[model samples]
Target chain A: MQQIDASAIDAVGIPRLLLMEHAGLAVVRAVHHLVPDPSAPLVICCGTGWNGGDGLAAARHLHERGHPLRVAVTGPLDRLREEPAAYARILRGLGVAPVECLTAEALGPLDEWLAECRLVIDALLGIGARGAVREPAASMIERINRSGKPVVAVDIPSGLDADTGRIQGVAVRATMTVTFGLAKRGCLLAEGPAHTGTLVVDPITIPRRLLETAAA
Target chain B: MSIHSSLRTPTGVTASLRNVLKRFERVRHLMTQGAWPEGRSVYGLPKIKQVKLKVRKAAAKEKEEAPAEAPATGAAPSSSSS
Candidate 1:
């Protein structure tokens, strides 16, 4: 599987956070459409990096809209790098106290949380994620998958590739995928469609003309 | 050209940008024209510089004054008004 670094986005000349906002809002809209109510109990699974930022943004936007949401940070929040950490702080400010359940023992509440929620968000392993899913994240993915609650995935299904639709170990099975900008070629392929449900492309503020120029 | 047909649209970072900005604009427009109809916005209502009318849904006008419709019906906002 080909790995993608979020820094490579710099070559596109667009702010990564802007992309995350677009991604988060789009996922929010999709989730709103699918769930019976905006306040329907939600369990958001998050990782570090931009994908986590995307999840955090969605949580912020949801909180801003008065949606009832609870975030489960599957990795150590300290494990997060720069930009994402800034966004994580925003989540805390909104009172969406994150459960840093990075291990199976710490994740005992996940099954309970999943059972109580109306929908689950797979912001766990984004496109930047590579290799097999470690402990808590993998187990979390399995629970979210097994729980049968509809999941809205940000970017590619966590653990799936952005270029190839290959999965490393366990990946979140999503009912709807709000992919940023364009539909990644991976989602159009086998493992992608299998993991990703109704694929929706929620491109950010970048100009269409700019994208066309890049293609040309 | 379709969702199932993997004809591979140039997901060049550029095309993705085009689609995203377009959606954001549409969302902003919907917010402005009052597509929610009930006017019960989720807050952070898309603003166009100092014009914030937080009308309750019961008070909202059904016909939102939309910008000129684009040829893209796929991106068109749905009307719940009968």
Candidate 2:
């Protein structure tokens, strides 16, 4: 999947930002399918990776559609990689600054935020995550699960082994998982099925022919 | 000549009828080609299509039997004192 994404960006010349935009738009569409209320309060939890980038972009889309939403980050904004950082900057420019929830105290208001929101978008981790989840992310996952609100996970749920379906220390139990490109093996295996309530295979901007080449 | 006689009534009606039939034929062709039948309105609303997915009964049963166990660490890590 990584190879295909790289090839689509490098060889196929599809911009990473455009791919992220499509992913985010697909996520927004999925959320609309579930919630259907544009006025409902929504919370999007993002990390420092591309998955978080998807959430950041989705936040912008949702905000544009007049949905009352807030973005919560599991880590410092400065730690975000290039693509995600660019999105974060865009969100900031739009006057939608994401709230950092790295510390336990920072997460104090999370419960209240979740209470007011209709659903949460979990963009905390993606297929790249392995080993046991660390620090603030693990705690954020716990809070989100306990919130009792429905969660829509981006790609594979955070802490889930994309191949083995193993839970590395912790994983979010999402009401729906919006995965891009193709379905991950983990989502259909072992504990993965339980955590991922309903799996949605959303398409990115990558050409079908380019994807087929990877399969070959 | 009388005004009624001057009007090309038969030709006008025949021409309109032909146009209507041509539109119907176009719609029939599209339907046969598996295109969604669009509504006559400007919105171009599509006909509702139903799609059903097969459920894996064994998988459903297994999911019910599965335990909701805590993570390996059991407890979340404490924050480092700022």
Candidate 3:
């Protein structure tokens, strides 16, 4: 079987947060396609990296479309470094209040909120965090699944290693995963295909030439 | 058509339309013998229409004269009253 590694696209530097914006847009469109006139609520789980940025962007689009939305972040808002922070700020501007899940205690209420939602967007981790899941995020992933609403993985399932598509013990069972930039290797191989559900590729604005060279 | 009762015809038509469409989809799926049948996944390599054949075989084998055996002991419904 042919296998591609996450390292192949490691150096493919997209503009600061452009990739995240596109990821958010793709998710919003896909959700609309599945439930055109949605009647239930929407819950988006955000992390502290570019993946979180993707969720924040998705929240904005979903809110504008008149879908009831709830945004939850795995860690503290203050700890969100750079791009994700900016994306959070944008969501704030769009009138979305971010709920932080910092401890196990928070999981119950988050689970309750998730239960009321029709769809859950799993942006807790990106392809970059390709190893064992750590801390609150792992528990958050468990709770998201237990809610039983359909999950849409942001880039890859949280706690899932993008390199080998290995689940580092903890992982999100997404019903559909919208991959960013050239379809990550893990999205096609190992247990990745099963855990990811349906794979939808969204190549965020990396120039074709640059993608070819960097991938080469 | 007037909103009083004439419009009810369209409503009835649409309800029947929905039923027809649903039945058509089920029949289409049953005929295809695709990846999933009756909401259950059909694992492994595609084979000939074995499921339908199996059902037919079981039905044919179960055709023992049990009903005749039951009525033979004078338990048949009395038709003299009719």
Q: State which candidate has the highest TM-score.
A: 2
List model 1 lDDT by residue over A1-216, tens digit each.
111223325555666677677778888898888985766889888887678888988888887877777798877888777767777888888777777986878888889889999999889877767678888888888999999999999888887876666788887889999986566655754477778888787646656655444334
Give the TM-score (vs. native) of candidate 2.
0.71
Task: State the weakest 10-residue window (summed lDDT) of model 2 chain A.
Answer: A207-216
lDDT of 3: 0.72
Top candidate, metric lDDT: 2
How is the predicted docking of candidate 3 categorized under the CAPRI scheme?
incorrect
DockQ of 2: 0.01
- Write model 2 residue lDDT over A13-111, tens digit each, in one string: 988999999999988988998899999999999988889999998999999888888899888999988888888898899889998888766788888
Which tens-of-lDDT digit does each residue in A100-157 have in candidate 3? 8887677777867886888899998887785578778888888887888888888788
Candidates 2 and 3 compared by TM-score, better number: 2
Worst 10 residues of 3 chain A by lDDT: A1-10
Chain B TM-score against the true chain B, each candidate: 0.20, 0.21, 0.20
C-alpha TM-scores of all predictions: 0.67, 0.71, 0.66
What class would a CAPRI assessor give candidate 1's docking? Answer: incorrect
True contacts kept of 2: 0.00
> Residue A36 in candidate 3 has what lDDT?
79
Model 3 steric clash pairs: none
lDDT of 1 at A117: 91
